[model samples]
Target: MTYTEAAEYILNIPKFTTKNKPEHTRAFLSFLGEPQERVKVLHAAGTNGKGSVCAYLHAMLLAQGKTAGLFTSPHLVKINERIVINRDQISDDAFLDIFEFVLGKVKEMEAEGLPHPTFFEFLFGMAVTAFASAGVEYAVLETGLGGRLDATNSVQHPLVTAITSIGLDHTAILGDTLAAIAFEKAGIIKPGVPVFYADTTEESNRVIEQRAAELGTPCKKIGKDAYEILGIRDKHIAFSCVNAYYGNTTWSLNNIGIYQPGNAVLALEIMRFVFGEEGRPDLWREALHELKWEGRMEEVLKDVYVDGAHNVSAVEGFLRSLPEKEANIILFSAVNDKDYEEMIACLCRNVDTDFYIITRIEDKRAAHTKELQHIFETYTDKPVFVRESLEEAIDFALEHQHGRKIYCLGSLYLAGMMKGYCNSGEQ
Candidate 1:
């Protein structure tokens, strides 16, 4: 099948919601000759900062003259962006080659009476094969959802396992409470593995601590063991890494956000563990200078910023990271069934900018404009109205907006659509 056809075929399959076991992935890998064991994996799992932490770790790995493989989900612009190696996407030729190989193996599985691999399972297998084929030294993986039974968890060994701040997201699948969610994320930890965690609520920390104890893993949590602060004007952030293999040094951050201190320290801590003391410091400086995490607190254009903050924790981070002031924002959103109303309320309360709500073109779960308007009304009767299309929404914001700082908030699909408007080939 062609690339587009392959993507559509993957999407058409019915989703398998339960985290039954890792056997599905294992079976598929066996069929493909077990390509997963060839690379060193750095696995990251959490609610808010998975993308940023993965980006940072991948960048640092590349700077150390190693071929790094990055696997993320729900692409902001192009499907190829989800699977990158050495800061470049897996090309059409490479994508097609491995997919066909995996599909053939999948058909063999079905013939042998095994269950069909789910969409995420297929993606995970493809990622493992691609990384092996490219001979990458390190594969930086971000879990698609919760961790306990995530398709990517078949890798019981990783150089380092990081758990970003746990928060209430994917509540139905993960659990209702932060502690429950932390337990799911902690699934990536194994015996003797060094765990790097960022700032988590006290309740969440208890759950993580329990899991680490059960696994017999030594953990270094960001805010608890190491910490950072934003420099003058927040153009830079600094962190002291006492727990890190790097010497006790205060790092100056290139990503501008007060909320970044947690993820920032987590990334540094991973580098310190991955490399020895000297390599950690050098890689840290190089990666921070070249860090580019799109859709999650990213500056896409000269004056416009975009963030895919689809849940309460991410929304809170977006608001906390930015200057507290009212500005015009081009907002487009699409969330899972569980988070729509709460996400709307969080956006309206903390992000008090002029919002232009746009409708998503393709995704089925997108909320209608009238429904969004009603939610906005519940927060305030202010005229942060809706637009029919993404172009119209951007046009509305551009026409009414007065200053250099432009912002876009809400879902990854929204960020992808607006990224279409920016019209750049890069993600």
Candidate 2:
């Protein structure tokens, strides 16, 4: 099948099947020759920052002269962005080849009366197959949702597992409390595998610690106290780790997210655990300096940025990264499942934006522009404008920026839409 046809088919799979059991996924992997077993894996899961952690680890592996593959979710522009090797996306031809191979296996499974893989499961299988086929030494896998039953969690063994900050995301599926959510994330901890996590809250920490203890696994927690942010310099956030191995030297990231330093340190600890003495802090430092995870405080244009801060906690982080004195203009959109009211209240009360522009993502889950506008109106006296079309919102934000920084946030889908629109050269 052609690339377009394959993508269409995969996207429509969700209509036919929901998430399968981890055992089902494992059996499917076995049917596909157990490609995940051929490569060492680093699995990461959390409410936020897991993708950033996975990206950092993949970059470090490449910097150390190791062949690596990175698999992430919620592609910004293209499905190809979800799979990468040696820092480049799987070529369209390679994606097509892998798609056809996996489709053949799915047909065989169906013929035998086995269920077909879900959308994420199919993509996960293709990613492992691609990585093994290309002979990658390491593969960094990011969970699409909660860790306990995520499709990526089907990988039974990983060299190391890391969980970023746990928060109240996907509360419908993963519990509502921090401790409850932590339990779901801690499910990725395997027997005897050393697990690293960002110690965000006391409740979450206790849950993770207990889970690790139950499995007789080694666990280390990295907290906010582990790193200190110096300042933002030249559009980069600079910080220093408290770890003695990192010394008193300050490290800088290419992006301007204050939360990134925490994510970076979590990846650093995982790398140290996996590579031991072979891992060079200096090389890893250099790799982090050049690392930039898209859709997280990414400056897409001259003074316009797109951030994936859909939840209340992520919006709080996005707020902490903004400039204290500069005038700002925010273009916001969110899906219906998110706590957009709280997110709007947090942003409205925290940042002194000149005004707010509300838009709707081109998805069925998107919150209506009028609904978002009403939320913004209820929170602050700031002028709120609504544009149902994302393209129109972009035009309005840009036209009225007036030398102020423009931030597009609230959803990954919004970030992806903005990036795709900007990349289309219509801006």
Estimate the TM-score of every prediction.
0.91, 0.98
lDDT per residue, candidate 2, 1-427, as tens digits? 7899988998899999876899989988988999999999999999989999999999999988899999999899999999998889999899999999998999988899889999999999999999999999999999999998998888988999999998888888898899999999999999999999998899999999999999999999998898899999898999998988888878999999989999999998888887888988898889999988889989999899989998988988898888883338899999999888999998888888889998889898989888888889999898999988988888898888778899999999999999999899998
- Score candidate 1 by TM-score against the native: 0.91
RMSD (CA, Å), each prediction:
2.8, 1.0
Among all windows of 10 consecutive residues in model 1, the one with the lowest summed lDDT is: 228-237
Model 1, 106-217: lDDT tens per residue? 8898899888888788888888899999999899999998987888888878888999988898888899999889999998888888888876788988777788888889
Residue pairs clashing in model 1 are: none
The candidate that wins on lDDT is 2
Q: What are the Cα lDDT values of the candidates?
A: 0.76, 0.91
- Residue 115 displacement (Å), model 2: 1.1
